[model samples]
Target: MTQRRTPSGQGPARRPGRTSRPTQRVRVRDTSSTRVEPRVARQARPVAAKRTAAQKGATKRTVAPRPRAITGRATVVIAVLVALVLAYTYPLRVYLAQESQIAKMKQAQDIQRRLIAEKADEVALWSDEEYVVAQARERFYYVRPGETPLIVLNDPAGAARDAGHAPAAPAADRWYDTLWSSVQAADSEPRN
Candidate 1:
């Protein structure tokens, strides 16, 4: 609302104005300097003088603007992906390993069940009178009461061949083992 008087005591009421350039507005801003830069100071700036010819010949100047700054979306996406993978990696590995272990345990349980069933069948046979008599005759070469014992010739070489490699036993343990065998034979007998 106020017309700033120049240092030479003139205001905007005069005809001398900054209408020389069309686009470039040279409004006299309220700077700290009392006067505009002198001609001597302008000539001292050689860099500005060298651009006078280029400014006159060019209608448009190609100015490369600065690249846009990075958005935070890419950083957020990478962080989320990293966190998701880190959160699931341990649990995924543990689940897979446990699944594998469970499969092995199932297989082992099936084998143990089959072996236990076979042992149960053997125990059932041990309670039969015929099985008890057969085992005593074959494994122990036992004879019935008042019967003469006759050795069979089948696989006679197998017993003598392995005899040298057989472990030695104390005579006291042999007597105890014979007593245990007689008890087992009595126990293996069928109930009336």
Candidate 2:
């Protein structure tokens, strides 16, 4: 163990610090006394590395954030979509109702056409005077020009056919077997 003592007696350590080794001091030339020592101190720990209020103030400036924008396109699109749906739905409902009504009107038109055809046939039949007279005689037992009226009971078919086709007994037929049927029918007969 040798002692390193500078001519000024100052060395690498200014004060004694604890070490795990026995004090085996070595003798070596100390370079700290040279004029280059200040640069050496600056190399070990820079002045900029230290924390200070003036140094913190030199940091880059930041701007406060502007308010975030609220996009309204999506809201407008949804509103338009709802309006379009209503527009389409209203017409669709009206079209369905109109379609059903058109079907009912067509059915009524077909019934009217059938009735017109039947009425045209009856009008043609009524144009014949013989048809008018025959119809009046059959329904009303009508006589014309003081003609004597006779009921002929001959059967081009049979007597059973005549009796079968004769005017149906009135509603009284069911009341008293045959008695009320005769009376009611006689009472309702056209006066000769």
Candidate 3:
């Protein structure tokens, strides 16, 4: 029987069912020629095996990195910021309200100041004797003790009648004479 030799030419051929150790490929340079070659020719793996190895390597390279979880320090920082805002909100609102109230009070004070000035001027005017006397005479129709009071009736008789007061009759007609004349006229009239 003839024995078959392996491709490396240093071992007996492997049987189809027998397991053997894997071969390592080593590169060698040919000094005579400028080309490089493998010292021992490697056996080709099956297509399915080659594809699975390639897919595993590709998945390793292309897989995305996992997202990192938030650290305790970062959480604490955010919490502190939220707490600070909550703490200051009420005080800020109160400060603004007080400022507005102060402005309103100042406005009311200015109005009061103006009123006081006007009253002061009125009081000054009343302090003068001549101004007080003039106001009293004009409003109350008062006169000095020795002064002759001449009352002028400038309005027409029609104005007096419209005001519900008829013009006075001549002073020559006494009240009794007018009354007797009226009685005689009434007696002469026919009864209705």
Candidate 4:
């Protein structure tokens, strides 16, 4: 017997030199009032046509979705967030500025404290009699009572004059007369 083959060639294979047999027909009794319709024959389609038909069906079923519009609730939430940010901006800036000012004030206070400590140390040093004597002796050439004072001159001319070898001023001309004469001489000179 020859085997029936499907259009897709997935049916059982046919044997060579076999004769085709007629299929048996079964008759069924009508049990319902519904009428039966005859089946329509299907034609084989090309692969490209089948693919295009499948693609058309897929496109019809799966349409591209449109972008959603913003809802009222979402808009209100975004507006609230923006308002919150705006409200916080000034306060945040002020807080940072005040913090920087506070830091600067603290630095100034630290510097003042250091200066006060230095002054206190200087006062403590001044309270010592030995340090005071040493400073006075070094700065003003002061000496203790009953101590002989000896002054050393740096200029050789001043040293020679102090030794009493220079000529003395005349008794007739007082010190003021000499000073006046020098001033008059300076006034008489021509200016550059």
**Maximum-lDDT candidate:** 4
TM-scores, each model vs. reference: 0.44, 0.34, 0.43, 0.44
For model 4, residues 42-81, the per-residue Cα lDDT tens digits are: 6655864876576532322233456569888999999999
Off by over 4 Å in 3: 1-62, 68-74, 145-192
Q: What tens-digit string does per-residue lDDT give for candidate 3 at 1-192?
A: 444554444434554555776666966666786765677886776964876577642322233456569888989999999999999999999999999999999999999999999999999999999999999888877899998767766777878888999798867888899999999999999998
Model 4 misplaced regions, further than 4 Å = 1-65, 69-71, 150-192
Worst 10 residues of 4 by lDDT: 56-65
Better of 3 and 4 by TM-score: 4
Question: Residue-wise lDDT of candidate 1 within 1-192, one digit each (tens)?
Answer: 444555445444533533433365668688786677755542355754676465654333335556567658877888999999999999999999999999999999999999999999999999999999999999999988999998866764577567765554445667788899999999999999
lDDT of 2: 0.72
| lDDT at position 35, candidate 3 | 61
Clash tally, candidates in order:
0, 1, 0, 0
Which ranges in model 1 have alpha carbons more than 4 Å from their true place? 1-60, 63-71, 152-192
Model 3 TM-score is 0.43
| Cα lDDT computed for each candidate against the true fold | 0.76, 0.72, 0.79, 0.80
**Candidate 2 to native Cα RMSD, angstroms:** 26.8
